[model samples]
Target chain A: MTRSGLRGLRAAALTGTLVLASGAFAAENPIKLGVLEDQSGDFAAATIGKVHAIQLAAEEINKAGGIMGRPLELVTYDTQSDNTRYQEFMRRVLQRDKVDVVFAGFSSASREAYRPIVDQFNGFAFYNNQYEGGVCDGHMVVTGAVPEQQFSTLIPYMMQTYGKKVYTLAADYNFGQISAEWVRKIVKENGGEMAGEEFIPLGVSQFSQSIQNIQKAKPDFVVTLLVGTAQASYYEQAASANVNLPMASSVNVGQGYEHKRFKPPSLKDMYVTTNYIEEIDTPKSKEFLAKFKAKFPNEPYVNQEAENSYLALYLYKQMVERAKSTNRDEIRKVIAMGDVCMEAPEGKVCIDPKSQHMSHTIYLAKVGADHSISFPKVWEDIKPYWLGEAGCDLTKKDPMAQYTPSNPPPKP
Target chain B: MDIATLAFSALYQFGDAFAFLVLSACGLAVIFGMMGVINLAHGEFIMCGAYVTAATVHAGLPLPLGILCGTLASAFVGVLVELLVIRHLYERPLDTIVATWGLSLIATQGTLILVGSTMAGVGTPFGSFQVGAYSYSIYRIVLFVAALAVLAALYALFNWTRFGVLARATIQVPHMAAALGVDTRLIYSLTFACGAGLAGLAGGLYAPTMTLVPTMGATFIMEAFVTVVIGGADVFLGTAPAGGILAIVKSGMTSWQGQLFGQIGLLIAVIIVVRVLPKGISGFVLRERT
Candidate 1:
C-alpha cells in the first residue's frame, strides 16, 4: 500500500472508534421520557394538568439526581385530543425520538388507538388516567384507579346514604358501557335496584328529557358516567331543571374538576369517588400542590388524572432504579415482583404486580352547594380486584387484551 | 304519577324539545335556507356568541346585556367573514362549504388559543317550578317563549319589511334586483349578518345551560343543519313546522324509549322527510299553496 493510502486508512479507523465511543457515552446520557398528551382540543382542559404534573415529576427527579445519575429528559408531543394524532404521535415518539419510556393517552379510545403501536414496537408505556379497567397488557402500566377501586367504594356509600333505587346516565362508548356494567354489578351486589339506565352519546347536550325521566323514576340518587365537555353539561341542565336527586359519579368532579368549572348549585349534592382532587388536604398532597402551584401558577385545578401522571413518573424512576437498568424486560420483571410502590400525592400507591394496575386509596367526595369539595369517606388501599379476579396475571401470561365483566377469562 | 301529571310531563317535554330545535335551526334557516349558502361554520358563529356572552357576564354585565353583546359580536364577525371570505364564494356553493369548514377549524382553534380551552359557565336563571312529580326549569319555558319570539320576529322582518322584500329579490334574482336599483351586495351581507346574529342569539340564550368550550358549538350544529334541511328554502313557511314535527318525534321517542332511540328516531324522521319531500316542508307547502 502507498504511504498516503495507509494514513487515510488509519484516520478512518480512528474515526470509527471515536463514533463507537460517543455512542457508548450517549447511552449514559439523560433518559428520554416520552410524554404524549392532549395539549389541545376537547380533552385538553382535563388532561393539560397531567402534562404539567409529569413535567414537575421530571424536574424533581432531575433535581434529586435522576435515576442512577442519568438526568430525565422529556420528549413531549401534543396529541390534540384526537385518536389519529395519538397514533401518529405515539409512533413518532417511539420510533424517531427513540424515547426510553412513554406515558400517553387520556381517553380509553386514545389509549386503544396507540396501544397496538406500543406493542408492535415492543415499547413500554404508562396509561395514567382513570378508566373502566380490565386492560391486561404486559407492555403497559396503568396507574389510574379502576372500577374495582372507584365503584366498589362509591356505589355502596351512595346506596346506603340514599336509597336502593338508582338511575344511571352513562356516556355512549366502551368506557361508559364497561363502567356502567361495573356500576350495575356493584349496585346489584349491594342489593340496590336500578331504577333506570341511559347511555348518552358524546355530543348530546340536551338533558331535559333525561332529567324528567329521572324525576319520574324518583330514584333516591343518580349515577352519572358522563364524559367530555358536552356530557359534562348534564350537571348544569339537571340543576336548572330542578332534578333534585343527589348524584354519584366516579368521573365528574375528580377528572374534569367540574366543581371548579361549573357555577355553584350546579354540582351541589354530588358525590364523587376518586383517588385525588386538588381538594385533598393531606400533608404530602399539600406539599405536592405547593410545588405544583409554584411551578405552574396559572393552572386552575390539580385534577385526579394529573396526580396519577405525576406519580407514574416517580414510580417509573423507582422501577428503573430498583431494576438497575433501563431495559424493558428488566423493568417488567421488577414491576412483576409486586414491590414497586410510591408515596404519591394521593397517598401510598402501589403497583399490583399481577394486574399491572395501581392499588389506590379511594376517597368519597361530596360537592357542597357552593361547589366546595369535602371528603366524607375514605377507602384505604383499594386493590384493582376486578382484574385479579378476572385472572389477569401478567407474570404468568401476556394476554395483551382487555377483559370486561361480560368477557371473563377462558377456562384454565 | 297521575294522568294529569303525565300529560303535563309529555307537554313539557314536547315544548322543551320544540324550543331547542327551533332555536338551534333559526339562524341557519336564514343563512342556508333563504340565502342558499352552505355555512359549515354556523356552529362556530354560535360559539362566538356563547363565548362573548359568558365572558361579558363574568366581567359583571347583566345577563341580558351580555347576551346582546354576544349577539352583536357574532353579527360583527359574520359581517367580517362575509366581506372577506363569503362574498367571493357567493356564486360557488361547493367552495363555500369547504371555505366555511376551514373557517370553522380556524375559529375553533383560534378561540382555543385566545381564551384557552374553556371559561366558567353562566348559571341558568329563572329558577324552577313544580308541576307534579317533576319540577321544570322556568328558564326552559323562557327559552321556549324566546324561540317563538325569535321565529315570529324573523317572520315579521322578512315578510312585512322593505329590506326583507329586497333581500328576497336579491337572493332570488340578483341581476334583476341590481338592475332595478336594489343594492344586492348590501342585501346579501345584511341577510348573512342577520343569520349569524340569530345563531349568536341561540348561543347566548343557551350558554347558561351548557358547559362552554370551543367545541361546544358542534353540539348544536347537527340539530341546526337537520332543522334547516327539513325546513327548506322558505324560512317563513318551513322552519317552525319542521321544528314542531321533529320535536314531536324526538321528545316522543325519548320519552317512550331513551336518548339513543330518540336520536335514531330523529334521523329516521329526517330520512323520511327528505325522501318524501326532497324540497323540504317549505317547498311542499309552497307547492300546495301555489
Candidate 2:
C-alpha cells in the first residue's frame, strides 16, 4: 500500500470511532418536540401568542435542565389557520419529524381535524386552548380551561347580578351553539329564564336587525358566545344602538382579548371566565408576564391560550419525567394515571385522569374602562364536567368521541 | 314594550337598516351601472377610507376633517386604480372583475401588512335616549338622516349638473359623445372616482361603529354586491327602492323571527325581484331608459 492510502485509512477509522463514542454519549443528542400552530391566518391573533408562549417554555426548560439529560428541540410549523394544513402538519410531525410530543391546535375545529391523525400514528398531542369542551380522546391532553369550568361560575353570577330574564346571542357554530345550550341549562338551573336567544352567523357584521330585536326583547343581560374579530363587532353595534344591557361571555376576554381590541365603555362591565389575564395579581402571573414581555416586547398581548400553552409543556415534561421515557405508551400511561400537575401562571393546574382535561383555576373577570381587568371572583380547581356528563371516561379509553349540544332550541 | 314604542323601534330599525344598505350599495350602483365594470375592490376602497379616518381621528384631527381626509384619500386611490387598471379594461367587464379582484387581494394583503389584523375604533359619538321601555341610539337616527342626505346629494349630482349630464351621455353613447367634443375617458374616470368617493364616505361614517380590520371589506362586499345587483343598472332610483325593500324585509323578519330568517327574507325578496323583473327595480319602475 502507498503511504497516502495508509494515512487515509487511519483518518477514516478514527472518524468512525469518534462517531460511535458520541452516539454512546446519551446527553449529547437532543430530543425533538413539535409545535404546530396558526401563525398567519384568521386564528393568528389568538394562536400566535400560544406559539410564542410554548417557545418560551421550551427555552426555559432547556435553561433549567431539560427532560432527563437531553435538550428539547422544537420543530414548528405554522398551520396558517387552515384545517387541511393542520392535518398535514400533524401527520408530518409524527411520521416525518418523529417528534416525542406535539403541543398544538388553536380552534376546536382545528383540534377535531388533526386529532385522528395523532391516534393513527400513536403520537401524543397536547392541546392548549380553551374550547367548548367534551373532547374525550386518549392520544391528546387538553390543558386549556373548558366551557363547563367557566360557565358554571359565569352564568350564575351574571344571572344573580342582572335580572332573571336573559338573552343569549352566539355565533352560529359548534362552540357558540354548544355553549349557548349550556347557558340555557345553567340559566334554568339558576331559576333564570331566557327571554330570547339568537345565533348570528360567523361572519355577519351587520347587526342592526339583531340589535333592534335585542332592544325589543328587553332582556336584563345578553350572554354572548360570539367568536372571532368580526363577531367582536356586536359590542360596537350594541353600544351604538344604546342596547346597554349588561353582557357576559366565556369566549370573549381570554381568546379574542376584546377588552384590548375594543374601545373603552364598549367592553365596560362585560364579564368573562378565563384561565389567565394580564391583570392577574398573582406573583406567578406577574413573573410570567414580566418574562414573556421581556422576551417578546412587541407582542400585542398574551392570552389564556398562551398561558395554558406555557403550562402545557411543563405538564408534558412532568409526565415524561414520571414515565422516564419518551415512549408514547409510557407517557400515555403516566397521563392516564392522572394527577399530572404544574404551578401555572393562573395557579396550580392538574390533569383530570378521567377526562384528560385540565382542572384549572378560572377567574370571573370584568372589563374595566381603559381595558383593565378585575377579578371579581376566582373558581379554584374547576374541572371539566361536560365531558363526564357526556359519558367520557378517559381512564377506560374504550372509545373516544366529541360531545356537542344535541338539542338546541332551533336556530334564531 | 308598548305597541307605540315597538312600532317606533321597528321604524328606526328599518331606517337604519335601509341607510346601511344604501350606503354600501350606492357606490357599486354608480360604478357597475354606469361603467358596466364589476369593481370587486369596492369594499377595499371603503376599508381604505375607514383606515384613513381612524388614523386621522386617532392623530387628533377633528372628526369632520378626518372623515373628509378619508373620503379624499379613497377618491385619490380610486382614481389611481382606474388609471392603472380599469382604463385598459374598460370594454371588458369580465376582465375588469378579474383584474379588480386581483387588486382587491393586493389591497387587502397590503393593509394587513401595514396595519396588523385588528385596529381599534373610536368611541361612538352620541349617547342613548329611552324610547318607552327600549332605549334607541341617536347615531342610528343620524345614520338614517345621513342616508337621506346622500340620496339627495346624489340626485342633485346626477340630475342637475352639467358634468353629470355629460358623464351620463358619455357612458350611454361613448362614440357619439367622443364625436360631440366630450372626453369620454375623463368622464369615465371622473364617474369611477365619484363611485369610489361615495364608498369611502360610507366607510368613514360607519368606521366609528365597527372594529376596523383589513378584512372589514369582506363583510361589506357581499351585501353591497347583492344590493347593487338587485337594484339593476340605474344608479340612484334602482338602488333606493332595492335598499328600502330589502331593509324592510330584513328588519321586519328579524323583529318577528330572527337574524337568520331576516337574511333569508332579504334573499327571498331579491329572488322574487329578480324572477319578476329581470332588469331589477329600475327596469320595472322606469320603462324608458334615461
Candidate 3:
C-alpha cells in the first residue's frame, strides 16, 4: 500500500476503535421510547397530560440514572385522532425508529387498531388510557384503568346511592357503543335498569332535543361517555335547559374538555370515573403539578393525557431495565408481567398480563362547589381491572365484593 | 318533560344544525352548481373568515364589529380568488375541483403553520337562556336567525334586484347575456365572491361553537357537500336552510337509535327523498320551477 493509503487506513481504524469503545460503555447507547399519539385531536388534551407525565418520569429516571444506565429518548407523533393513523404511526415508530417500546395509543379505537400491528412487529407498547373490556391476548401493556375502574365501581356506587335507574349518553363511535353496552350490563348486574340511552355525534352541538327527551325519561342519574369538547357543550346545554339529574361521566369533565370555551358551573353536581383527580395531594402529584404549572402557567394544570404520557415513559424505562434488554418482546413481557411499579397518584398502576390493560385504583369523584373533583375514597372492585393482574392471582377472593383493598398499595 | 318539550328540543336542535347546513351549503351550491367547481377549499375560506374575526378581537375591536370586519375580509378574499386562480378554471369544473381542493389543503396546512395546532375557543355572540326542560343556546339561535335573514336577503337580491336578474340571465345563458350588453364574467366573479364571503361568515359564526383548528374544514366541507347534494344544487339558497334543519333532526334521531351509523342511515334516506324530488323539495312544494 502507498504511504498516503496507509495513513487513510490508520485514520479509519482509529474511528472504528472509538465507535467500539463507545458501544462497550454500558451507558453510552440510548433506548428510544416512542410516544405516538394524537396530542391535538379528540383525545389531545387528555393524552397531553399523560405525555407530560411520561416526560417527567423519564427525566427523573434519567437523573436518578436511566434504565440499565442508558438514557431514554422520547419521540412523539400526532396521530390526528384517527385510528388508522394511530396504528400506522406506531408501526412506523417500531419499524423505522426501532424504539424498544411505544408509550401511547390513547382511545379504545386507537388501542384496538394498533394492537394487531404491535403483534405483527412483536414490539412492546405501553398503552396509557382506559378502554372497554373483553379484549386480551395482545403483546401491548395498558397502563390506565379499565371498564371495571369506571363502570363496576362508580356506576354501582351511583346506582345504590342515587337510584337503581340511570340514563346514559355516549358519543357515536365504537368506543361509545362498547362503553354503553358495558354500562347496561353493569347496571343490570347491580339491579339497576337503564331508563334510556342516547348517542350523539362526537362534537356536533344542539343537544337540546336529546336533553328534552332525556328529561322525559327522568332516570335517577345521567352517565355521559362523551369524549372531547362535547363534554363541556353537553353540560352547558343541559344546565341551561334545566336538565337537573346528577351526572357520572366516563370522560373527565376537567380543563382539557374545552374549558377555554365552555367551563361549566353546572358541572358542580357532576362526577366522573377518572384515573387522576387534580385535587389529589400526594408528594409526587404535588411535585408533578408544581413542575407542570411552572412550565405552562397560562395552561391549566396538567390533565390525564399528560399524566398518562409521563407514566408511559417511566413504565417503558423500568420495563426495559427489569428485562435487562432492549429487545421488544422482553420489554413486553416485563410490562405485561407487572415487574415494575411507578408512583402513580391514580393508585397502584400495573398491567394485567393476560389482557394487557392497566389495573389501578379507580375513583368516583364528585365535582365540588369549587369546580374541582373530590374523590371520597379509593374506589375498588373495578371490573377487568388488571388485564393480567387477575390471571396471576391464581388464588382469588370474592370477585363480587364491592370494594377491596389494593393488593400492593401504590405509593402512599 | 312533555311531548311538547321533546318536540321543541328537537326543533331547536334542528334549527341550529340547519343553520350550519344552510350557511355552508350556500357556498357549496353556488361554487359547485354555477361554476362546476367543487371548491373543497371553501371551508378553509370560512376558517380564514374566523381567523379574521380572531385578528379583529386581537386588534381590540368589539365582538360584533370584529365579526362584521371578518365577513368583509372574507368577501375581499372571495373576490381575490375569483380574480386569480378560480376564475380561470370555470370552464373545467373537475380541474377547478382538484385545484381548489389542493388550495384547500394548502390553506389548512398554512393555518396550522401560522396560528397553531391547539384549538382556541372564540367568544359566543349571544348569551344563553333556558325554557322548561330545554335550553336554547342564544348564539346558536342567533345563527339560525342570521342564516334566515341572509337567505331572505339572497332571495330578494336574486328575485327582485337588477343584479340578481343579470346574474340569473348570465347563469342561464352566459353567451346570450354578453350579447345583451351584460358582463357575464363580472357577474360570475361577483357571485363567486359572494359565495366565498358567505363561507367566511360561517367560519366566524362557528368559531364560538368549535375551537379553531387547521383541519376543522374537512368535517364541515363533507357535511356541506351532503347538504347541497341532498338539497338540490339549483335554488340551494332556499334548501340550504332546510339542509341544516334536516341534519339536526337526523343527528337528534341518532341519539334515540344507534350512534353514527344511524346518522349515516338517515343521510341515505335523505338521498332517497332527493331522488324522488329531483328539482328539490322546494320545486316539488311549489309545483313549478319558480
Candidate 4:
C-alpha cells in the first residue's frame, strides 16, 4: 500500500473511533498526550527515568478517574536520541496523531529542533528537563531549572564556604558556554574572583594536562559545566592526580546520576545544585518515592529530570481540569491565566506568569562518602530570573526568543 | 609558574599525551600494517577489553588479574572473529572493512543488551606526587612507561624470536614462506591475536580513568585511525614517531590554549604529515642511502 494511503486509512479509522466514543461516552473522547522520549541512545541514561516517571503519573491519574471524565491515553515514541527523529515524530504527534499536549525533549538541541514544528502547528509542549535556560516561547512551558535559578544560589554558597578564587571547566558548547557565563556573573556578584577558566571539547577525555593546569592555577575550588559520559573522566582523573581543590559543578550529579555510577571518594566533597534527589527526607518526597519504588521495584534511584517529568504531568492535568476542556487553545489560555501550582516532591512549584517557566526550590547537596547525596541547605522558591532580566513577558507574547548573555566575561 | 616547574610540567604533559596516542593506535597499526586487512572493529576490540576488565574486577578479582583476564578475553574473541568472519575476507580490504564494521555494531548493541549502557570502573591505582608547583598522576607516568615497554617488546619479538621471524616472512612473502613449509595462515592468526592483545592491554589500563560505557570505543577510535594512517605501514618505528609528534603537539597546544585548539592542532599535524610525507614518518626515516 502507498504511504499516504495508509495514513489516510489510519486517519479515517481514528475519526470513526472518535465519533463512536463521543456518541456513547458523554460526548467526550479520550484526551491523547504525546510522549517523545530518548529511550535507547546517547540521552537514554538520563531520559529513560523521565519516561518511566511520566508513565507512573499517567497510571496514577487514570486510577483517580482521569481529568474531565476522559481517560488520558499516552502515545509514546522513542526518539532514539536523534534530533532528526525528534522533528519527524513531533510533526506526526502535532498533526497526524493530533495530541492535545506533548511532554517531550531531553536535550537543548532536541528541544530547539522540535520547537518550530510545535509553533507552526500551534501545538502545546512541556519541556521537562533542566538545562542552561533562557527560553521564552508562548507555545511551550519549560519546567526545568534555568542557570539563574541554579547558579544564583549555588555560586555564593560555594564561594563563601570553599574560597574566593574559582577555576571553571566547561564543555565547549552552547549550554556549557552560557552556564559558564552565569558562573562568572554569580561569582562577581558574590565578590569572588575567577582564577582560571578553560573549555574542553565534549569528547576529549584525557585530562592529565588539564589537571596539571588546574593545579598550577591554585584555585579555591573548581567549577565544571562538563557534559556526557566522556567528560565524567574528570572526576576520576582529578582524584588520581590529587588535584583536590573542592570541586563543584553547575552540571553533573543528578543529571547523569554520576554519584551512583562512579565509586565513592571520587565524587566525595563534590557539590551539585539540583531540584530533587532520591535522598530527600521530607514526608512529601518520601511518600512519592515510596509510590514510585512500589511501582518499579528494581529501578535505579530517581533524579531531578524524572521528578520534573512527574511534576509537569500533574501541572498539565491541573491546567486541563481548570479549563474544563482538553482543547489545546483552551488549555493554553488557562496556562496564560497562570496561578497553577503543584506541591511537587521537591517543593511548591508554580508557573511564573511573565516567563512561562517554573519557579521552584533548589537544593545544594554534597556527594557523601557512600555515594549517596545529602542536602546541606535548601534555597526556597527561586524564580527563573534570566527571562525577567530580558523582559520576556510571555503572557504578552512579544517574542518567541531565547535570551543569552551578550557580554560574556573576559577570560581570566 | 617558575621556569623549572613549567618545564617539568610540560615534559610530564608530553609523556602523558604521547603514551595515550601510542597505546590507542599501536594495536590497529599492527593489524593493518601486518595483515593487510582493515580491522574496523579495532575499537570494539578495545571496548571488549575494557568491559571485561571492569566486569571481572567488579566480580571480585584483583585489579592486575582482572586486567590480564581482559586481555586474554579479547584475544580469545579476536581468534574467534578470525576463524569465523575474518578468514573468508583475507586480502579483500573493502570486504574486510564492511564485515568488521558490521561486527563492531553487533558487538556494541549486543553488549548493550546483555550487560548495560554503563558500568562502574575500577579505581585508578597509585596516587599523585608534587612536581614543583604542580601535581602529576602516578598512573599517567605508569602509562608512559607502559607504552614504551610495549613498543620495545614488539621490536624485540619481531627481531629476535623464531616465531616473529616466521610471521614477518609470511607477511612479506606468503607464497614463498608457505612453499618453504611455514604455516602462513596460522602465523596470520597469531599476528592478529597479538594486535588484539595489545588493544586489550590498552583498554584495561585505560578503564580506570574512564566511564565504562558501551559506546566508549568511539572516543578512542578517531585518534587511533589518524595515528595509524600518519604512521604508515612500518608498525614499530612509524607508529612510535608519528604518535609522539602528534601527542607532543597536542599536549603543548592544550596547555597554551585549551583542549579544543589542542585537538585541532593534532588534526592539522596529521594533514601536514600526510601531505608532505606520503610514506609517513617511518618511510622517510627508513629511506635508502643515495
Please report the candidate that would top DockQ against the real structure. Answer: 1
Question: Residue by residue across B36-113, what tens digits does model 3's lDDT show?
Answer: 577878888888877888778767888778778777888888888788888788778778877888888778667665
After superposing all C-alphas onto the true structure, candidate 3 shows an RMSD in angstroms of 6.1
User: Candidate 1 DockQ category?
Assistant: medium
Second chain alone, TM-score for each candidate: 0.99, 0.97, 0.90, 0.97
Query: Which ranges in model 4 have alpha carbons more than 4 Å from their true place?
Result: A1-30, A95-97, A407-412
Better of 1 and 2 by lDDT: 1
Q: Say what the interface RMSD of candidate 3 is.
A: 4.0
Per-residue lDDT of candidate 1, residues A1-412 (tens digit): 9999999999999999999999878765889999999987778889989999999999989888888989999999989888999899889998999999999998898999999999999999999999999999999999999998889888898888889998999999889999999999999989989998989987799999989888878899999999888889999989988887899998998888888889998999999999999889999989989999999998888999999999999899889988999898899899878889878888898899888999999999999999987889998999998888878888899889988988976657
Candidate 3 displacement at residue B227 in angstroms:
2.4
What's the true lDDT of residue A374 in model 2?
A: 86
DockQ of each: 0.75, 0.52, 0.38, 0.71
**Reference A-B contact fraction recovered by candidate 1:** 0.78
- Displacement of residue A25 (Cα, Å) in model 1 is 6.8
Ranked candidates (lDDT, high to low): 1, 4, 2, 3
Q: What is the interface RMSD of each candidate, in Å?
A: 0.9, 1.8, 4.0, 1.3
State the number of backbone clashes in model 2. 0
Best model number under TM-score? 1
Worst 10 contiguous positions by lDDT, candidate 4 chain B = B281-290
The lDDT leader among the candidates is 1
Model 2 ranges with Cα > 4 A deviation: A1-36, A40-42, A62-103, A116-123, A324-327, A404-412, B288-290
